[model samples]
Structure formats: C-alpha cells, structure tokens
Target: MSSANLDPLSRNLLIGVLALAGTLASFAATTAPIQAAQRGAYEVTLPRTLDASGRGIVSGTMWCSEGARCAAPANGERAVSLCGEVASQFGEVSRFAGPQGELGSDDLARCNAAVVRR
Candidate 1:
C-alpha cells in the first residue's frame, strides 16, 4: 500500500509509537549513569507524620548510606509504606509532573509493595 493511502489515525498511531520508543531509549541512555550512582549506596527515611492526602512525607535529611553493604529495608508492608512515602514526596515536587513523574510514582509504589512481600 502507498504511504499516502494510509488513514490519518493509523499514521498518527504509528508516529506516536515511534515517538514513545524514541523517548524511552533517550531516557534509558540518560538515566544509566544516575542508576549506576544510585546502585552505589542509598537510604530513605520514613516520616512519622502523613500529609493531608495520608501520604508520608520523607524527611530531606533522611538518606541512604553510601556503601556496598547497605541494603534496602526488608519487603512487606514496610516497603510499600516506604514507596508510598517517596511517591508522595515526589508528587509534592511540581517539577516531577508528567510522564516521568507518573513513572516515578509507579516505581515507588512497586518498591514499597515488593518490600511488603519480602
């Protein structure tokens, strides 16, 4: 079939898919270093209080220690709670808005949920 004969919606969908793939690739490339750095050492502190939305606010002072021995908290409710807290904090930051922000929220939730299972 001739390219010009394709429906506009189909063409748009094709373009959108390509765009999404490109974006994903670009993000992976850019995030590789940051991910590597995060792998080195990290910590997240849980807050005692929850926001109006019932989400925990992580204290800025709380941080992961740098070292190979440091490990994330064991999975279960604790992990889900931690992820919820991180997601909440990220939500509060306006800069994190959009697809990237959504991904961040999902990541936090998954991490927390995984912890609960552990």
Candidate 2:
C-alpha cells in the first residue's frame, strides 16, 4: 500500500520507472521548441511595413516584423494554411516560401484571401 510496505527491489524498480518518465518528459519539453523553431518554414512578406504602431505579430507565426516579413513555424500545417495565418495577421502576403518552394500564383491568390479588404 505505502512505500514502507514495499520490498527494496520493487521500490528500486518503481523509482527507476519514475526517473525514466521524468527524463522523457524533460526531453519532450526541450525538444518541442526546437522542433517548432524548424518546422513548416514559411516566410511571408507583405507589400509594406506594418503600421508605425505594430512591431510584430507572434500569434500565428514564429516571428513577424513590422517590416512586412513573417516566418511561420506552422507545425505541420500546409503552406497554404500558414500563408493564410500570416496574411490574416500581417495583411496580404505577397510571397510565401515553404519546404517545397514558394507558393504558385494561384495558391498565393488563395493565401491572400484571408486578408480583410479595407
């Protein structure tokens, strides 16, 4: 029932399992950000810098500067999907480059659709 009631071998085995689990958890925690830092790999460039007030957008991408550039870590989302996210946050995306390559004219057109026309 309690630790005091457990034999030495059993207790050692339990400790080993717990330690292993902790190590695994720690490993996952550290590896996630690294993986996130190197995924989807899409960069979105807008027509102009963000308004003087907005310096960056972090909600949808890894880092988006006010200078009309955004890089999305996008996890496993399709390039098209990430382009939409960047466009929605930073305005129409003029270019989107991902793992395979840059989006084609048609795909770029679709990616810009997320931008609200003012």
**Top lDDT: which candidate number?**
2
Report per-prediction Cα RMSD to one decimal: 16.2, 4.2
lDDT of 2 by residue, 11-114 (tens): 99999999999999999999988886666466778889877544444454456464677665555667787777677767887888986789998998888888
TM value for model 1: 0.31
Error of 2 at 44 (Å): 0.7
Q: Which number leads on TM-score?
A: 2
| Residue 15 C-alpha lDDT in model 2 | 95
Model 2 regions more than 4 Å off: 1-7, 52-63, 81-85, 113-118
Q: Which pairs of residues have clashing backbones in candidate 2?
A: none
